[model samples]
Target: MPKKVVYLVVLVFFLLFHPPVFADITVVINELLPTPSSGNDWVELYNPSQNDIDVSGWILDDEGTSSDMLKIPDNTIIVKQSFKLFYVSNRLNKDGDTIYLNNGTSELDKYQYISSETDVSFGRYSDGSISWNTCSPTPESANSNCEVIVDPTPTPTPDPSPSSSASQSTSTKSPTPTPKATSTTTKSPSPTSAKLSPQVLSAASESSLILASSTSASTSPIPSMEATQSALSKTKVAGLLVGSGLALIGLSIGFYFWYHRVLGNPKKEQSENKT
Candidate 1:
């Protein structure tokens, strides 16, 4: 009958009827090992949230068109921040297949693979990124724990066959000629020897000039390592000098302003007050 008692009763009723704030618990298909080395095809579910989720009524199926939902076993619970591997004992399509995870009414996650290599998994990464090549077969482990599989041996390319004409030529090839020894007779030069023709002499002179020019160009001087080191040292010293000068200038400007504010202002204020 009292006012305070009535208000307390009303507050209690409101508190009891208010909907509870549930945590965001998302269960994602973290990893899929459709073609494992020894076991049946399994999919790993990751619970990244802090709250424990009950997957007892959840359904997992490969049915894209028909009702082929496999009911999760009773008492099926995935603890908070853990991975749960569900085995799909049925034969999965190696060429391509679609996998769907759902509750009775709504779908949780859906993954479809176009093609998957044997013993290689195609699933999401730790960051929930689904890519065919980025994910590897982890089976019972977390998606992040899966190592990227890289084939070290490169694929061998088939050698091109030789043509019929080329094969025949190779089979009937002639042997390489051996060098035959010949005696050399040197002609002694005499002052009365006939002089070379003018055209031939001109051509020889031009070729000699070209050879000299090329030799000079190729032998042009390049900067030595010591010279480069000296230049770098000079540049570094110049930079240091510039930086020190700028720092000194900044300090001078700051001191000028600080002195005017601290010492000059007080004297001017006193003079103004006196006036």
Candidate 2:
């Protein structure tokens, strides 16, 4: 009976003095949707701790002095390290606003914005991180990295002109070839024997006939002077031939006598003795 009372007192002290577990819950306002297309605006909450947290009786509001707030229903559980979305009855502002999340007793988290882009949300770049960025709307999920990609435009190339092509052809052309010098050779004449005419006989002829003709009439004698001249020329030619022949005969007789004188003539001596 004594041990039971002491155990009861220890239980009461632990129950009363220990701080409430719900107050230490870690829940953050991760993403916000200020402008909606056709429904009430909403805010997403995330519990980053390892265990599930009870967010019942939690309050979400914008501009602390206004009536734009949402009280969570009882028995609401935000799963550990997960996302939970809550609709806020068109409470957020498109251009600028401030938001708050509290456990009905103490403030848990707050966010402020100057402007929100259309069709997008304002949230932490990495979930549970203090750095904020404008990102695509991700309800009840992890936030996305903020990035923009743009396509580059292509540039066109210009076509070549006729004048430019002609200029290039002219620049690459070869020079004209020079003509070579030609040489000429001269030929010498060969020695040839000349042909003699009838008037200038080449062979020897001692005697020939002489004829005389008179173009004009002459009355001196029966024979003309030209005829007389011709007869005399003929006679002189005949006499020269006769002289040449007699000289040859005389040379022969002289040679015969000279031979007899050198050698004895026995036959001529015998004939002289008989006479």
Candidate 3:
């Protein structure tokens, strides 16, 4: 009876405290891409695990601000061998960016950067302590004792003219006339050379003029075939994630049932013995 009770307790503890099967899955911030806009940056996540892992509830942070916690559905798995790109709204400032991945109450990985440069030190959260990655050294990672350090050289930023001065300059400058000589030489005659009747010409002048629009309107903005192929390759990663999530859900359910059955049997036997 006591043995059965002990077994049940152990099972409960395991369920409560033990890490998930794929908890060993490591996610590295492989790359950060800057967008044309300031807030529309993206970060790439690389799954360096041998098994598919679910990143649901995994938090992605920029600098110190918590952005989003990924709510990956069951059957949504990052494949054993794959790279996942997570689009982050906040831009990765060269000054610093800290990315932390946590599971429930425990943190799994913490990447701290003083400068978003070539080499940075990443720390792994293990046994409630941080283990820093120190092999790759940069100006920021020079301090071996510290988790991360900033580069001595400050991050370069584009110089902005004072708003008042800029506005004043703009107001003072005389508007230059569009050089008629250059315009006459550059502007080609319309492809449609059909002579318009007086009535048609009058009507056309009264209505909107199509050829007067900018030439950029005629160009194709959609991506080419090569770009489409690249996009397809990136999208294929979603399949890997989906498969991993399904497997995790299956494992979690199976473990729950198996634990209950194994532990519950002993409890039943103990009760029978007591009776």
Candidate 4:
């Protein structure tokens, strides 16, 4: 292969996989301590990109003529999203000054500020932001918190919970009893028995029927299981009502005797007076 074509092929391969030469120029003068209270004054460089940066010939300087600029060492590689620190001790003006970064040619970034407090460092918010703030010196690490531009993000509306499919149990309905095809003859009203009125006799007949139904219900071979239980319940209710009625009558008779015993009987007193 030709020499130029071979060289071109190698360059293209490295570029495709992100070699250091073609990395985007994203390095910024991140942090700097102008007024150092304890240690020497320092400046920090940061590369906030995924690809490594070859900041070999980059320059760091304050407001001075040609002789005062500091040149980065050759093959000085700053890995992605990392920091580099240089001790420009006593170089920065403690009162106030501007710091500049250059790629041996055009300027990369610069920061100008008024006088800084003692031991405080000024830098972009996180690393490469335009906004600057001051905090305790954080050399070769992140700057103190004032570089980022945060817009308020609205809280996402929570999705409505899906309605639960509640399983509603249908109530077991008591089935209506079907009538037989055979004719149902009404009993002819019979003469009153033992001075009982016809209405009372009719009621007595209905009571007898209810009792018979309840008694046979347990042993009766009914088709539906529910119908048998319903008949049994009806029988129990009728028995309870009859028992309550008898108890009420007994109580009424006992109360009549009690009243006569407690207070003197008016009829007996009248007869004694005549005597």
Most TM-score-accurate candidate: 4
Over the stretch 1-275, how does candidate 2's per-residue lDDT look in tens digits? 99999999999998786544764447889888888676878899998887777888889988846563899999898878899999988788788889999888888899988776666788886888877877888999888866432234788888966798798888789566789864322243334332333354533221221112232334355888999999999999999999999999999999999988767677778889999
* Candidate 2 ranges beyond 4 A from true positions: 1-25, 147-275
What are the C-alpha RMSDs, in order, of all predicted structures? 23.7, 42.6, 40.9, 30.9
lDDT of 3 by residue, 137-250 (tens): 222112233343334788799897579878888888969779765433237554455545579988887665555454457766988899999889888888889999999999
Rank the models by lDDT, top first.
4, 2, 1, 3
lDDT of 1 by residue, 92-145 (tens): 677778888886777778887766677878766653554434355665565554
TM-score of 2: 0.46
Candidate 3: regions farther than 4 A off: 1-20, 34-39, 66-75, 116-275
Off by over 4 Å in 4: 1-12, 16-24, 145-275
lDDT, residue 119, model 2: 67
- With a 3 Å backbone cut-off (N, CA, C), the pairs that clash in candidate 3 are 75-242, 75-245, 75-246, 76-241, 76-242, 77-241, 77-242, 77-245, 78-241
TM-score head-to-head 2 vs 4, winner: 4
User: Least lDDT summed over 10 consecutive residues: which range in candidate 2?
Assistant: 204-213
Clashing pairs in 2: none
Ten contiguous residues with the weakest lDDT in model 3: 134-143
| Per-structure clash totals for the candidates | 0, 0, 9, 1
- In order, candidate lDDTs are 0.73, 0.79, 0.57, 0.79
